[model samples]
Target: MPSAPTPALPQTTCKSLDDWNEPTHARRIYGNTWYVGTCGISVVLIATPQGHVLIDSAPEKASVAVRQNILSLGVRLVDIKTILLTHEHHDHMGGLASMQEATGAKVLSRANVVDVLKSGKNDRRDPQFNELAGFDPIVNVHAFEDSSAIKIGSTQIQHIPMSGHAPGGSGWTWQECEKGVCKNLVFADSLGSISDDSYRYSAPDSLANALRESSQRVAKTACDILITGHGTASDLLARLDGAKPLLEPQACVNYAQAGALRLEDRLKKEAVK
Candidate 1:
């Protein structure tokens, strides 16, 4: 699958790219999975004979580096067949519009976020809501349900609803095999109870309640390897760089607990406020 290189993005005058997109080397996580994003964010690649699957994209400025890294790993942009987003956050999908154009891949997202993606507007239902900065509008998006198992060649990706940190947030899971041993890799979505000053995670807020349930469900789910949307969340870079072990049986459990605690703490503060 030979394809032309992704076109260069003109250098923007803004300082955001320099701050958010710390240049980081890309590397294989396990088997066919690869970590190919900036230091502050996470972009994943799963390759197969039919094509490849890309999970998340960097901020707009970081997209160039991401595409370069993909090429460095010998993956053609056109080989990326399916593009999935963990949420509607700009840091996660700012590059998606251009990425979709570059790769000519089908963009799949939760049905609820289709409008936000197409319009390049903040999702009013999101905790951050009006505080969010819009990204470039994406086009030709297809909706997929949580129960749908998206298959491309030998790879199968499943979605797990985790709409609390933000609307349309989700976790993804897939199996990766290495040297006769296979590990269930989970790309857990952001679980931080972040919000604008006006928002609260208390029971009255429907989104907050959803997060509570999501954390409980995620805590119970078992997986061999966990890769969070933020590299720092699971110490992704450390694990990939050999500073820490990658396979921890209780990773998801611990992650969920930590997120739940954060949400609880936020709620307590909101009560006081």
Candidate 2:
């Protein structure tokens, strides 16, 4: 039987986007720590004492809505010190350049994402990448080879490299909540489903191995909350026995593999039909 869904909190945004609604289903898992994000789509903003850090940017059209929400909170756009790119896809990096121009926030992404955005050399010819390619030169991008620590007020984030989503895909771990009680890890993409855009590229086989390895590592972490790219912050640890956790990129490859297998079976059944 399927598990019941968690009730979402009341959504409040500064600006409205007719295309997408504010995330009304966000849950406050730990005290002073809420998943101010939506299932399957969102640009998660973490408020720390040091400054604000955005996980990803929403689509081009939704940027205004996001900016309004931040301003509504009485937070200046300039206070946002970092805009982390989860991937190079337009949905994830859509308002990157604009946000940077408006707030002077530094952009951090995997080297591959930077390369693709700068060079447009990837095999996939999706228009989103092209759009990102155009923004590459305008934005100030800083590349991190592996894991790094970012301190924001009371929150301490550990940025871990879990490539596959992007050559430099990463997840973040919040050491302790503001209330000083709960500790959570934002798996970012390490233990989550692939974004819809992964369909554009023929995901390499090595990506699966990377995800499997990353999942195993994530499974061993002390995180109580796992924020994925899509879907909800699952109690994955609570149901590890029945669940199969794969990293962000590995999960993409697995998802593609599963689709291929399903298609083959469908073809067999349809031939008989």
Candidate 3:
């Protein structure tokens, strides 16, 4: 007898691209940390009495809404004295030129990323450079070494280099306090092995080794709350809805492990090809 016919899988429809830039009301993530980016991207504001530190600026098109989000939080854009980045992708740093021009905030990131930021050009080292566009140039960018501490008022942000997603990709760790208790907040870089059709994880120039080491470091890092470059990756919305605990001690480890598995799978497919 013939085998049973295979059942068709459910078809998935692409979500509306407009939803990516739609203005979502800003909300406090925890303590002084607030979410101010779009529904698709992750931008965080860490408020300090002296000033404020913003992480990532979304794309240029959505920057105005991001600024509005900040204003809605009762924090002046001028009060943003420091701007840190998770990576130098156009989607992440596209608005740096506008935001920095408006606030004159000191931009900080890994040295290589700073170069890319200043040039407003895609870094050749990036695996997807040919498929990506450059953003507005940001002048006088400063470099921060891995594990360096950046202090703004009472808040301290530690930079951790995780260079696999992007050559200068990095993550941030900080402590937010409320009611005499503090929680460690981690903003991890994009960890998925995403690329255009022509790109391969098995390419000689791929930063697979660096990415593996970075994933290991992230797995070992202590985290109470985890935030990622994209909201969906870390379930930022579900957590905000009170359905999930604010403090997830093992979140980073899980994130790293998942990323590692993705890398392994990509390499396996490449080997077969």
Top model by lDDT, which number? 1
| Deviation in Å, model 2, residue 55 alpha carbon | 1.1
In model 1, state the lDDT of residue 85. 88
Cα lDDT computed for each candidate against the true fold = 0.83, 0.52, 0.82
Please give the ranking of all candidate structures by TM-score, highest first, separated by commas: 1, 3, 2
Pairs that clash in candidate 1? none
TM-scores for candidates 1 onward, in order:
0.91, 0.63, 0.90
**Model 1 TM-score (2 dp):** 0.91
- Model 3 residue 147 lDDT score: 77
Candidate 1 vs 2: which has more TM-score: 1
Rank ordering of all candidates by lDDT, starting from the highest: 1, 3, 2
Clashing pairs in 2: 8-25, 49-153, 50-152, 50-153, 110-168, 190-247
Work out how many backbone clashes candidate 3 has.
0
For residues 9-120, write the lDDT of model 3, one tens digit per residue. 1222215323446566576787888888787788899988888899999888889988977877778788898999988887877888999998889998787777788888
Model 1, span 1-273: residue lDDT tens:
322223452222222323457657677788888877887788999888898999999899889988987886778899898899889999889999989999999899899889899999985688888688899999889998864788887678888889898889888889988799999898999889998777767757458887887788688776888998887789877787777998988999999999999988988888897
What does candidate 2's lDDT look like per residue over 215-259, in tens digits? 554554555555554443343322222344422324333433443
